[model samples]
Target: MSSFLTLSIVQSALELGCIYALVALALFVSFSLLNIADLSTDGCFTLGCAVGAVVTMAGHPFLAFFAAMAAGVASGFITAFLQTKMGVQSILAGIIVNTGLYTINLMVMGFSSNINLFNTNTIFSMAKELSESEVYRSWYKIIIVVCIVLLVCVFLAWFLNTSLGLSIRATGDNEYMVRASSINPGFTITVGLCVASAMTALSGAVLGQYQKSCDINYGTGQVTIALASLIIGESLIKKGSIFKRVIFVVLGSCLYRFIVAIALRMNLPAEALKLVSAVIVAIAISFPYLKEKAGFYKHRRDVMRQASKNV
Candidate 1:
């Protein structure tokens, strides 16, 4: 490939990777920390895009971003309420919220199934307007996104070590124990879900601005993709420090994007991308089990060989 082509591919991968990393971080909070599946991610992502795009079209790009985050928080809170107050299962609550958000997002977008932000003032556009050089304009959006991701990682790391964060973690680890300690596990769960949803919403808002459009199905199967990135990051880092783990989550997002880029370069069909994501997640999830099984077989084989020799 030409140098320019390679550069373009790399740039695209980096941008997408950052977005994926945000989603993965959100998933890490919900799945790894809160122990909730939180399937509302798919709808919340689309909701962010829709909210951002509509508000951008109305001449308030920054407000649009925050609005999207607010919408995501609301969605998350609803799911939490359903699970905690109404006695609904977490997975079921997520599904219900996810299903409801489709209509809500559509309503937010004025019944349009999709909206384009091209030429409209977006957060990135505003950033470009502030910078004088064309080169700066081209790179500023990505730089801002990287900064946001880094800030989020640092904040999350610090938060996880705090008393409230510990309580949240405890809820995930052992709800009964947390309840016994007089900590409200439900409240912790709600807070965690809200934070996770906000992260996802931020990702969607940025991605929509970057692409200059918002599509209704933009977040299809996002949970699997986020899980894949999280697991891949965890496997690669294998460290216990919360700070390092968060950094690894971002790295894993980039790695997942790189893999997808390579797969695209190989000319994989667009229709198969979901399958690829599923396969990647499956392999990551099953790796420990597979390793244990292999070790067991190897040990058994060694014991049998030793017995035969003795006989």
Candidate 2:
């Protein structure tokens, strides 16, 4: 175990963890804050990768991020419009958008299954070139990802406290109440989903640049990954301020990546990793309920024993 758990392994895990945390943060906004299950995450993520890759290859590595986010915002608006105005169910709306995004993503990739950036400059490469110290140079990727995560966390924490942000939270808690207050629940929902999708796309953009390649299947199972990370974070933190919650979500992503790293070191086959993720997600989601049931049974047993003694 010690042999495989080297510093390089830890650093690699941290980089990936921080990058994926963006998606977890996105889930926090859509699922936790807005009470919406945006199933378009998987497709939106790939769309970001495709868009970022295309833009970066066009000599605009920095601009790729904004382009990808804009595409995601558009996707989110469509989903929101379908649900809020066209009377489609939220889940069904997400499904429709996700289905359409596949073709769109392919088109963005020039109908190709993959785009390689081996000869193209990426954000990570730019960061590497800008690093001054040898130590920092070695960790340029980590520095980039960590800074990005910190910025996102701080932005989300601040946004959630603003008036519009509060309204979005209210819409999540009770749309009827928001409507009663003339808050325009539809508008809040649209804003919430748009922001969430933008974050998700940004995550994909970073990942694409980090890998220096983008595949059509790059975002497969991203929804599961984000959901699992979010559940794990919530399970651990339980109750906290918005800032604390968002911070722990990043930590949870790191921990999840660490677990996956250890699993890989266990000589497990590649196919078994998905199963491990599923198990982890299931356990994380059910932990609170299981703990509650256990406590209830223990209390009942103690009460019965006390009654017997009294009798």
Candidate 3:
């Protein structure tokens, strides 16, 4: 491929990576920090997109951001309420909310499955307007996504150190300990899920605006993608401080996107595309355990050999 073509592909990957990083960060908040799987992510994401698209259609692209987050917070609250107040299991609560959101998302979009925003004003369109005289005009999406991702990362780093943040982490680490400390695990979980869902919704808003369209199916399997990216990111920065680990999640998102881009270019059989994602996720999830097992076997073999020599 030509240099220009390569650069184009890389740029596409970067845009995708940056967008997905927001979801990974969302997962980080719930899965890593709050110890909640929050299976409602896929539905919550589409909810944001639908809500954002509808709101932004009314000539207030900026307001769409907060509106989507508010929708997300509501989704999180419902799920949390089920878990905390109704005594539903965490996973079951997520499933219940996720299924319920399908209708809710459709309702938000006026019972439509798709919304077209080709002529609408979006953050990217604004960026393009400002960068009309600059070479960065073509890269407006990347610029917007990177800025949003950075802001989320910074905000999360700050939030993760606050008293509430510490309580959330403590609840994640050990709910029993949190209860004994007079801190409410239920309260911490509710806050954590709300925050995570907000981030997820923000990402969906960005994606909807960037694509200039919203489709009901846009959020399918997003949780799996975010989980893979999260595992890959945490592996890359295994020993980092909280801030470093959080930032690396963005890097991992980009890296995951790059891997997918390359795979797509390889012209894999159409039937195998889904399988490819599954394999990637499986590797990301199991590689560490496999590595440790391999080392253990190697050490056992070496010990056996030494014992034979001594005998």
Candidate 4:
């Protein structure tokens, strides 16, 4: 590729990566910290997109973002209530909320399956208005969003190091132990889910504004994508400090986007995209396991060789 084309691809990858990183961070809170598989992300994301699109169309771009966040929090609350109060499994509760949000998102979008804000005032447009040069205007939106996401990640990492954050981590690691220490596991789960869903909502709002449209199917397979990103990030980074982990996650998201962009440029068949994603995730998730197995085989081979030589 030409240098300009390479630069363009890198730019697009970074922008898209930042967006996906937001979703992955949300999943990290629930999956990595809360020990819950939240399927509600798919619905909540779409709900946020729908709310943002509709509100922006109604001449309330800023409010639209918060509205979407509120919707996401409500969805999280419902799932939490189901799990904590109604005695449903966490995964099941997420499924219930996700299913419900489908209809709710449609309602929020004026009962339509999709809403296009192609010519409406969106967050990107607002950013453009605040900029002078066309190039700066084009870059400003992504830069602002990336900065916000990084701030959130930093805040989360710091929070996780706090007393309350420790409690949340304890709840994930050993709920029984946390309860023995007089901590409420239910509360921890609720709080984690709330934060996670809010992040997901923010991501959805940005995505809607970025694309100038919101579709019901926009969030389909989102959970898988988030999981894949998290797995890839975790695999790439050494588990040391919280700050390092957060940074690694962001880097992983960027790397994942770059890979996808390269695949697209190679003219990979659309039908193979899902398979590619699955393969990537599987390799990431199984890396440690594979390493262990390889070590075992090597040890066995060494022992056999030594025995044969002695014989």
Candidate 5:
């Protein structure tokens, strides 16, 4: 336990938490705001990593960010098209896109399963170069990610306040009401998914650059992880403005990563990580319901006790 609390391990967990917080934010948009279940997240994340890594290796680290986001936009557009035009269910559209993205991601990686960037110049490297002292250098990654997350949170807060953004949130709450009110729910859904997917891709790009490599399975089970983070965040902050919620999302991601770090310290095997993720998700999902159940039982017991005293 003490070893897990070491500075280096804590820093590593913080880095991972910051990276994955983007995905949690993405889920907040698609799942919470748009009421969409986008199962294509894993593939989209890998696609971003592959595209970003390939482009970064070509000596264009900055361009890699936009390139990866563009790929994510294309992926999002296809998923939206399938749902809006082809009449596919939202979940099915995501599955179809996720499946097709696997091949596309592979192609982007030059048909290889992994791309090593051992000597590659990535965004992290660029950030590190901007720092002077060794201490500042160690903090570069966190600073970069924190700045990006802050910008994103501010942008999202403003966006959600806009008319179109309000329409997106309304569409999620009641599509028929939005439709009857002269707003196109389809358009709102499309835009929301695109924005969400782009955010997820950005997360992958950051993770890939930070790790200094890209693997075919880099994004496996990422959606579950994001969902868990989101749920944990919601648990922490039940009701708040968008800005507050976004902050909680970041906090939740950090907490989730911290838990994983502790588990790893306990000598949990790599193969069991997914199961651990599933359990965390289960607890998060059931927390509210379980709490309510306990409350109900307590109330009933209290009522019976009161009646017995009166008798």
Candidate 6:
């Protein structure tokens, strides 16, 4: 128990949570706002990692972010084009893009399965050099990740309220209504997906730098994790403005990480973490429905008690 409460453990969980919060935010945009289930998230995430790793290894750490985002935009564009122009279903389009991205990712990694950044300079390392204090150095990773998460939250708030953003939202709510209002649902979807994928790629870019390595399997189950985080956030913040909702998405990611960290501390094998994630996802997905059912049953029971008293 005491080991679980260590500052190092907490910091690690928080840093990872913040990094993954970007993925959650991406899902929030595409899944919740735009009503699109992008199954390419896992592949897109690895694409970001591969691109970022290659760029950083080439002596341009900062450029890796933009490069990764560009790659993500391209991936999203292909998926969108398939759905909008090639008459592919959204799910099928995502699957096709995802499958293709695996080959591309391997090529980006020079046909290798992994890339190590053991001695490479990354954004985290750059931040660490800005301060001389040991405490500052120790917390640099968390500071950078938190700052990025905050910036992304602010961006989501501002962007989602814009005219174009509103169009995307409306397109998700009712494609016919948006089309009747002279807005192109296809265009809105393309823009929304591209933006969301950029965020997801950014998350992967950060994670690659933080861990100082990129693995082919690093992105596996990313969509499930992001979906679980988004659903957990929505369950926690049932009614709020968009900004508040986005903020809670970060919180949810942190909470999920804390749970996993605790499980690890309790002697659970690493292999079991996937099962844990699956369980969390199932619970998060079903929570709202279960809550409504419980409420209905309670209401009926109360009504029966009142009628019995009157009789």
Candidate 3 clashes between residue pairs 3 or more apart in a chain or in different chains: none
lDDT of 3 by residue, 1-311 (tens): 67433977999889989998989999999998888899999999999999999989998899999999999999999999999999999999999999999999999999999999999999888778874565677677788888889999999999989998888889888877887898988898899999999999988988999899999988888999999999999988768677899889998889888888778778777567567778889999998899899999999999999999999
C-alpha TM-score for every candidate: 0.91, 0.95, 0.94, 0.92, 0.96, 0.96
Per-prediction count of colliding residue pairs?
0, 0, 0, 0, 0, 0
TM-score of 6: 0.96
On residues 59-125, what C-alpha lDDT tens digit does candidate 4 reach at each position? 9988987888787788788888899889999999999899999898888888888788988988778
Q: Is candidate 3 or candidate 4 better by TM-score?
A: 3
RMSD of 2: 1.6
Residue-wise C-alpha lDDT for candidate 5, range 1-311, written one tens digit per residue: 37548988888888899889999999999999898999999999999899989999999988887888888888888898899888999999999999999999999999999998879898788778875998997788888888877887788889988998899899999867986899887788888888889888988888889889999999899999999999999899889898899889989998999888888788899889999999999998899889999999999999999999999
- Pitting candidate 2 against candidate 5, the one with the higher lDDT is 2
Better of 1 and 4 by TM-score: 4
Model 1: how far is 16 from its true place, Å?
0.8
- C-alpha lDDT of residue 169 in model 1: 85
Show the colliding residue pairs in model 5. none
Candidate 6: lDDT of 197? 91
Q: What is the lDDT of residue 131 in candidate 1?
A: 65
Judging by lDDT against the true structure, name the best candidate: 2
lDDT for each of the candidates? 0.87, 0.92, 0.89, 0.85, 0.89, 0.90
- Give the TM-score (vs. native) of candidate 5: 0.96
For residues 238-278, write the lDDT of model 1, one tens digit per residue.
65888999999998888888888787777789888888788
Q: What TM-score does structure 1 among the candidates reach?
A: 0.91
Q: Could you arrange the candidates by TM-score from highest to lowest?
A: 6, 5, 2, 3, 4, 1
lDDT tens digits by residue: candidate 6, 1-311: 37547899899999998999998998888889888899999999999999999999998888999999999889888888898899999899999999999999999999999999988999888888898999997888898899989988999899999999889889888877986799988898899889889988888998999999999988899999988888888889888888999999999999888878887888989999899899989998998999999999999999999999999
Best by TM-score: 6
lDDT of 3 at 38: 93
In candidate 3, what residue range of length 10 has the lowest lDDT sum? 131-140
